[model samples]
Target: MADAVFDEETNVLLSQVDIEPVDANWFDIETDFVLSQFNLDNVLDMDVKSGNFPYSQTIGDLNVEANKTETGNCSSKRFNFEAKSSDVKKLQASSTPLNTQKNTRWDVNTWDDWGKWRNDRTISAGLKESAPYVLVPPLTVDIGAAELCHWMCRFILEVRRQDGSEYPAESLRQLCISIWRYLRDTCRRYDLNFFDRSKPDFADLRECLDARMKELNVSINKVKKQAKPINRTEEDILWSSVFSLNDAACLQYAVYLYACKLFGLRAADEHADLSVTQFTFGRDDVGQFIRYIGGRSKTVQGGIFHKKVLAKDIKQYANDSNPRCVVNLFQKYLSLVPEDGPFYRRPLATKTADGDQNTQHRRLVSIPYRSSCRECAKGQVLTASRLDTLVK
Candidate 1:
């Protein structure tokens, strides 16, 4: 009876299973179809017609033509294709990779600009054409330790803004570092011996930079007048004043100031980059809040090296009781602006009721703002300079 029951279960399971037989020639047919898509004859013909297959022959022909050219006679030795090819391959291997070349170009341009500035300054100072302090292209000149030190000292002491004000201590430090980096990179690229940290010159350079920086700081501090920090009471007064005003310009200013404080934004540029999409309304277990998703900033630049340093997501809870609540102000501001685009935009202008042709009033009007440039209508974002002016 047990054996009969087991057999009945096995038969039922087998009856439930359905298997379809595949054609034996299906694999062959599929393989043939894929192979047929690539015409070997056409590929070979194209390569031959394009003069690509016989790479060695093509290179030899080019070399022969080059040897017959007038510029080819400038070199003492005849053009050796094999040797030249090997050298080029080695250079390509040793040089900066294609992926990183974009960043290197910016550095190169900066270095060249610095060199030009140095030249201009030397000329203005009525120095001789052979002035040791004047900077030249790192790749073209071989800088010695003493020469470099002299140049750094002169640069720190002489370089000034258009208004003749001295550069800030931090700015001077960064400039020195950037120039050093350019020199170091040039040395590595051409296999030169200058600017190596292991050398005594490097040690002297470091000590000089440290000493100059300290001196600069002391001198700058003697004359530096810093702005007073806004106290909480002062802030309250300012906030109340801005909030009380029902004007469009005042509302925008309030929102900008509130956003800056809430988001812990320090630089004017950061505020300029803010947009509507960066903020979102969400509900948590406690209550409703406005969440801000941060991106690239002064401290946190998202890259492979900064993978561990995650972008910060900040939340500001809603305060219904407070008349000057950030959440309420933000919501009201959003309602006045478009659903998308920059957080801050140009204030709308409307004609006054008096019908004076020259009189116009600025107010919050909900409409898409267009850029002045006809070719591109997208760059309507508030600029850092304008933000600075507003803050002042």
Candidate 2:
């Protein structure tokens, strides 16, 4: 009525606001979409801007090329700790001196645009080699392949993020050996068969790793004359552990510990990681966790698989939480994990175990946390659900 008294045309325009648009975050992202899991009212401080993201197939037949689509959209999110975001942006702005951190320029955008820039640097270095090495002059392409090992080493054993808090630093020597094994297996496609002496890329590191592997095997033989070999299937036998999932609460932890003992999982105690999909309920509603594959799964045939789990025929299993200890663990620990974070993950103890003294120390001291995540999204996706007009 007041708007009509001042300006009738403006009032009509205001009244005709689209319901979806009015409820959304000023972007096309729907409130119903967010509200399906989180209360839209709980979120605060939103800033809208243009950003870029890519959508592509997770894995495809090598003969088939993945279709690529690049889109501009909202990129980052900040909930609490406004100061942390400020600090990062400030550091980004303060990058002044080019070639400051070694010949590497800070102007490298995307945080991953080091390809051409690094190639340019390599040639620049190769051109500066001294006289005696002229006959064996390094190729224009040089970024000490040893540094590649170090880059991977950091990934293998660096301090892992524990949901952005509480970290324990540890060396990744055994972890590197595991990674070396995986790389030696994976690099085969790129003509980098590290295990084969004939492959060109099979060089010093692979040879050393091979020798080290033999040495470790010999050492392990000397030490473990009586250790039982429990393969993955044997370990994941949860009816053997504190079994079943009758209670929504208790089944949660049993599922977690089963992952831990069976799959060498570490982060299942986190509730947010549990998704509607992970809860594979049978016709009888008997639910059980199946398997989680990594995004960079060589098994999945691509760089990343967006969906982590495969619904299997394992639901004929069990759901009566008899032992009750697992229920205690779930209530005391797993229940506290955010309802929207990654699902179960392998523990540091499992991933990095090899009789390393330091690893043992950390296992005794550090809390378990997952650096990896399985995205939690429901198959029953929410769309343009909106509030009724005039509360009718």
Candidate 3:
């Protein structure tokens, strides 16, 4: 009513107040047709003026603006605008963040864009690298159920690790299950019919896959039983020479071994999660107890693991000629480490002369706190490869 009153007083139409003059040459009819397909009628409200059309839409303060440029043909002008509509919002909501840390869905977008070719290319690439292709391709929608069963069997035989060992049967079964889940989820997103429960098409494929998985589970259990823990003799040898070692790498590794045993941390978990700030000391009746919160890993049941050790337990391992004392070693390691940083660090080169024992001892004992240890502090945590080498 107010707009009509004002327009009548000014002798102008209310609709003409904010509307832009349209020129048909400035409008792209094909683009308008595409927008109309999604029922977004109000998105680009173009009006015809002098056989020309200019797009305009206004809702409250929101308005669509288009930049027009005349084509060489002169009969048409290209219209470009920032597209923001309800369909775009729906798409943004559907796209979830992938689990890149685990590398499980690292190639999800690439695989989706390339469709079945991504799976085939992955298999070919894995074959060339001699690594097990854990990503099992789902039975193509166009293939028969019998063909899927045949493909599954062939896939199982073809998959092998970089070390030339076949994937454990349990892992193969898991891969199949994971692939099926991925296919079903993706199909649901696109509103496609993936499988019919009432039909017998998938029955044979399911039966054969389950049977293979059962056989593989039994073999997996046997392999798990045969697996052994780290040798105790090797642990002793590692700690025994740690005191005589002045090398930064050796010291860093010694700290790692003791920390692993003290906290029962997995190699990957400790390397990634263990930092200088994770340690704290408390007093008890026995003596001081050192506690640490270990980082999370795949095998770790809880997201975080808390472990504590009595200072005396590590003190027993200490000797005049040996730095096997976990507490002392941790303290020395802490002196060189940054607060809230990685507890284990890669070493820098030694500045002391190779033949100068006194100088090396002085350098080790006189390491300045809060000052950068020259050629001996790389600030990196111990890695799996480094851990393996330290063990050997």
**12 in model 2: Cα distance from truth in Å?**
57
Better TM-score candidate (1, 2): 1
Model 1, CA-based lDDT = 0.58
Candidate 2: the clashing residue pairs are 51-73, 246-319, 266-345, 266-346, 266-347, 272-339, 273-342, 273-343, 295-304
Please report, as a residue range, the 10-residue window in candidate 1 with the lowest summed lDDT: 368-377
lDDT of 1 by residue, 87-114 (tens): 9767754444332344455545655666
User: Number of the top candidate by TM-score?
Assistant: 1
Model 2 regions lying over 4 Å from their true place = 1-194, 200-255, 258-272, 280-313, 316-392
What residue runs in model 3 are displaced by over 4 Å at the alpha carbon?
1-168, 184-202, 213-228, 242-247, 299-323, 350-392
Which pairs clash (backbone N, Cα, C closer than 3 Å) in model 3? 23-52, 23-53, 24-52, 24-53, 276-341, 348-375, 348-376, 349-375
Q: Give the top-scoring candidate (lDDT).
A: 1
TM-score of each: 0.51, 0.26, 0.43
Worst 10 residues of 3 by lDDT: 361-370
TM-score of 2: 0.26
By summed lDDT, which 10 consecutive residues of candidate 2 come out lowest? 383-392
Where model 1 places Cα greater than 4 Å from the true spot, the runs are 1-150, 153-171, 181-197, 214-227, 349-392
Candidate rank order under TM-score: 1, 3, 2
**23-108: candidate 2 lDDT, tens digit per residue:** 55566654345556765323321211122213232223322442221111222332334467879866654442222322222211
